[model samples]
Target: MAKLKSLMSCAANRLQQASGLDQTEARIEIRALMQHSLGGVNHAWLIAHGDDTVTDALRVRFESLLARRIQGEPVAHILGRREFYGRDFAVTPDTLIPRPDTEILVETALDRIPPDQACEILDMGTGTGAIGITLALERPHAQVTILDYSEAALAIARENARQLSAHNVAALHSDWFSAVQGQRFDLIVSNPPYVEADDPHLQQGDLRFEPITALASGTDGLDDIRRIVAHAPMHLKPSGWLIIEHGYNQGEAVRSIFSGHYFANVHTVQDLAGHDRVTLGQLT
Candidate 1:
């Protein structure tokens, strides 16, 4: 018992010093590692009885995970789960992390779609199944189709749908609208790759771990957004809504794209941070 505590304390201290995280974060991560090693036991149970000596095998496993986390790996990837829209989702390197800004797009879409009406929604580049699955779960009457270019990402999205019990969602492997030709949607939403290829932020933090194709959009970062706007009218019902998340500086450009396409009620929504993170337009 005493030996296990000593080993954990030592590892936590080393991780704290090397990673520069605060003491609280370091302790939480180390305890999470211990809990993971104990067959996914609750943190409270582990804290109450963790002093009990663990097997040598468990100690080795804990150390391996700690080492990996110290190397700048995202904890969500390490734990294989990310929480989105108040739901836990399985995630992997193949899909992008579900960001909070995306919730605005979801909320806006829900507001625009009539609950009593059976609607079809198209979520382009639906990584991790966050947007489409959330919509399906929120509005059971709605049928959602999620499209992604990467087969691996689609696999992850499918798993998330099954895990979330979002049976109304249909996952497809498509580059934009290729797989759903001749189908029309009442609402079309996307958070496509909007980061410019030359953005320095891409080389820092968790962005460094995400796939480039899921982050960068040509040289201007608006290439995918442009393509989506140009093609959305064809797939949308006459009055369908098109909502999208983009960089804060992209609101004007996105609004301009919608204006050029003759969309009505084109406007931008600010995220919690007060940045213009989402833009919406109604097909005229």
Candidate 2:
């Protein structure tokens, strides 16, 4: 009992020192780690109870995790999971961490597509299957196909799909539409790599641990968004909607890309934070 208490105190101290997280945030995270059965609960509970004698082995492991977190490793990567659109998804270094801004994209897509209609939807660059899987779960009758270039990313996405029981989603290893040549969908959505290659943010926080292929587009960061806009019309049914998430400042550029095509209703949607984060257009 004393050992458990000591370990918890040491862990909390190390986490606080390493990450500069206040007592409340650190305690909350530690509690979640315990609740998730990561084997730290007994120590945490004992520590909270004022026990102070912990084993060397447990101390070493806890310190290691604290060090990693202090280095800016995302908690999601450390835990191997993230919650997106009210669903938990398996995440890894191979894919991008699903962001809250992207939820606006999913919500927008759900609003645009008719739930009762048996429509085909395509999710391009579906890292962790968050967008595609959510759509499949919400619109069971909709046939959803998720395409990603990286095999490792696709593997994680497939696992997320299975875990969520979203059977209607088809995971495809493709660079955009290359593998699914003749197939088309009633709606196409993507939260593709829109970060500029040399963006300073890429060197910081969770982005540091994410795969570059899933984050950086090109010099201007519009490379992937432009490609999706240019090619989406080819894979979208007439009158279908193509929605995309981009850097807050890229909305106008994305909308212009759509205007150059046969797409109509070209516009942008702001996220809850009031950033122009999503752009949508309909195939005419």
- Compose the digit string of candidate 2's lDDT tens values, residues 81-100: 88898888998999999988
lDDT of each: 0.89, 0.84
How many collisions between residues are there in candidate 1?
A: 0
Task: Compute each candidate's TM-score over C-alphas.
Answer: 0.88, 0.86
- Backbone Cα, N, C clashes tallied per candidate: 0, 2
Q: Which pairs in model 2 have colliding backbones?
A: 3-53, 6-52
Question: Over the stretch 128-236, how does candidate 1's per-residue lDDT look in tens digits?
Answer: 9899999999999999999999999999999999988998999999999999999999999998999999999899767888889999998889999999999999999
Error of 1 at 47 (Å): 5.4
Per-residue error for 29 in candidate 1, Å, reads: 4.7
